[model samples]
Target: MHNEPLAYRMRPKNIDEIAGQEEIIGKNTALYHLIKKGHVPSMLLYGEPGIGKTSLAHAIAGTSDLPFISLNATVSGKKEVEDVVAEARVTGKVLLFLDEIHRFNKLQQDTLLPHVEKGSIVLIGATTENPFHDVNPAIRSRCGEIKQLKRLEASDLLGVLHRALTDQERGLGKQSIRITEAQLLKIAEGVNGDARKALNVLESVVIASDEENGETIVEDWLVDNLIGRIGLFSDKKGSHFYNLLSALQKSIRGSDVNAAIYYLAHLLETGDLVAVNRRLLVIAYEDIGLAAPHIGAHVLAATEAAVRLGMPEARIPLANAVIEMCLASKSNSAYKAFDAAVRAINSGNTGDIPPHLRDTHYAGAAELGHVGYQYPHNTPIGSFGGWIDQQYLPDKVEGTEFYRPVQAGDEVKLAAIYERMKEMKKNKR
Candidate 1:
């Protein structure tokens, strides 16, 4: 219809008509062949908004020659699903395209399980949220494949714009419009890989433009006026935020100061100073550990200052901490040692504490097996205060070693001390 939105009007009629997602429906791809052969299966598609999860479902239905039934999980209930099932029974087979499928509760999801399993309803569920995290495992497992659609690139959006501009049947081809390739690209890039958004913005600009001598001129300024200040794609509770955090830690761990700063700035843009500070603290201890032990205290101080300063100003201290962490000598020796010790304990290596190492503070302790406890403070061997050679570990783990200090920063000195102690203990001196 002429009144329909350009994006809806330009919806691809089939897999071949779809502009992007070549990886999923490219002619040579398995899904393409499956759809072409009328073998479409129940599937779950997920990604960011406007990347065409619904479009893919419709295209698959079109290619498979199956009746397409649409419903939104947020609004649709068991009764609606039952109606679809009832229709499927009559039709023999039907493609059910459930939008916002992650919003479905366990009971609601379970309602479709039998129908999906029996092949009566070929479910093509779509969601912006990650299915693995939000969808029930039963629904996820029943899907033929959990397809992860990517954000449409700027080039993909450009193609979508070109199609809309030329297609007289569904697009603006009937009108005489003047818009440059650069201006089209501006619309494409401004939407941040969202073709639907791109088309909407394009429509807004076109409608705003007045006819000048039989030509509707869409200008550069018009596009910018509509798509003001594009923000980075990130959600505090979503996968992308975690990805930014991961990238920040990894860059710092790899000692790439530039990359570390970039990711830090990216996270800072999200205004999550607490998350940034917390992750920085973790990086300091977990990655930079005994290598530069003071780094932990430094990071703690920086994070504290950041909390006190808050926001706009908080970024300064965080940037300082990120830089320091990126350049700091890295060693996971201490982290690894603790993990190894845990592994030993998990594997049942724990045994009773040696008699000499057990606590002796309780009354009548000497009567029990806790006697013969060697107090290290009582025996000092030349410059080694509070030191002695005695069995400390339980018999089962007596000789098991965990702390292996690496040659990094202050840990090098620790390694030497550790070696001397080990040698002294070995000689029982």
Candidate 2:
């Protein structure tokens, strides 16, 4: 048992023994009820890698004492799936754990539909990719539940490490290795919520330790040295990726240049140029909107340059863009106004286009009262330069104010001009 990797040897044999995902496996949770009743359904377990999707599937089968069959969709073909179905038929029912289910194409996924529907096979599919975007819709619909397993919390990972250290049959307990709580925590933190990675690093640290009188003492320095080799797994497709992206945008919006630059570097390290560019464009329009509208154009230019140049060199323009955005005055008035306008329209407040504001170029448009539209270009007001006091909105929304500009950055000048225009219009009225 010592020859096997610590992660594989310490696989939880029951639901109660599972380390993390309290939201999904805690008492009174849906998954908990399913396992307790021994009535496991077809479920799609989606989350980041090394977070125990396969282990949970095994635990579910073990709890029910049902026949369990495992397959990897990346390698399993039609014949392998047929064999599982045949075995299920003989056993009356079987728990089929298909890992990386997203790798299965449409036809491969379809093969399981009939058996799953017929109660011959209870499918427990696991995937890191989002099921909605990657899995076949048909197969997705058949899965009774789609439970999302979150990344294990730090404390939960610590418990897992402690368990491996004490379990004599399956873990390093036989080795008499002494490690401190703080040292264990270092391994937990370095893995970024991946228990398998934490266990592997712990095993390596123990194996490399110098033994004295059959007792191996794992010093902090030895753990630190081993940890340096294991890079933190940055899941570009998982929730962590979105969390980091959110942090970057919030940092820029909060005017923290250092934090914005740090997150930008992290994304660049992951080689997610497309996400970086998309997020920068969104931040410009959403966070720095109206206050510094010109930043949008500059952001686009930077994005273009980044895309053309690619990596190392691309980071220059991206860094410049991030710095500029972080230092600029932030506002969400434009975004808020658009959302408000959308809500009003969705609530059935969509008024008909005013006759004067309707299209007048097409033939017969004038017959429908589309004429008498005031051309602002032809009616310039004094000192206003090609501007005129005119009602552009429909009568129902004539006085509605959707855009309330703030007194920040370029919006200050815009607000002044808007107030001046309102005063001129009031006098004309």
CA-only RMSD, every prediction: 2.5, 4.7
Candidate 2 has an lDDT of: 0.87
Error of 2 at 220 (Å): 2.8
lDDT of 2 by residue, 1-429 (tens): 457888999988889888888888887688798788988889999988888899899888878899999999999999899888889889999999999988887667667779998888999999988888878888788898998987787798899999998999998777788788899989988876888888899899988989889899889988888888464557786756876899999999999999999999888877889998999999999999889999999999999999999998999999999999999987898888889888888998778787888877788997888877777888776776688767787777787778888889998988899888788888989
**Clash number by candidate, in order:** 0, 0
Residue 203 C-alpha lDDT in model 1:
85
- Candidate 1 global CA lDDT score: 0.86
Total backbone clashes of model 2?
0
Q: For candidate 1, write residues 1-429 as lDDT tens digits.
A: 389999999888899988878888888899888888889978899887788988888888878889889999999989998888899989999999999988887767767779898899998988877787888788887897888888888889999999999999999898899999999988888886887888988888899988999999988888889877552566776777887899999999999999999898888887888888889999999999998999999999999999999988888888888899888888999889999999999999899888766778999777777877667899876776888677778988978889888898888888888998889887875
Which stretches of candidate 2 lie above 4 Å from their native place?
229-231, 235-243, 250-262, 294-327, 332-386, 389-407
Q: Pick the candidate with the highest lDDT.
A: 2
Candidate 2 residue 397 C-alpha distance from true site, Å: 10
Best-fitting candidate, measured by TM-score?
1
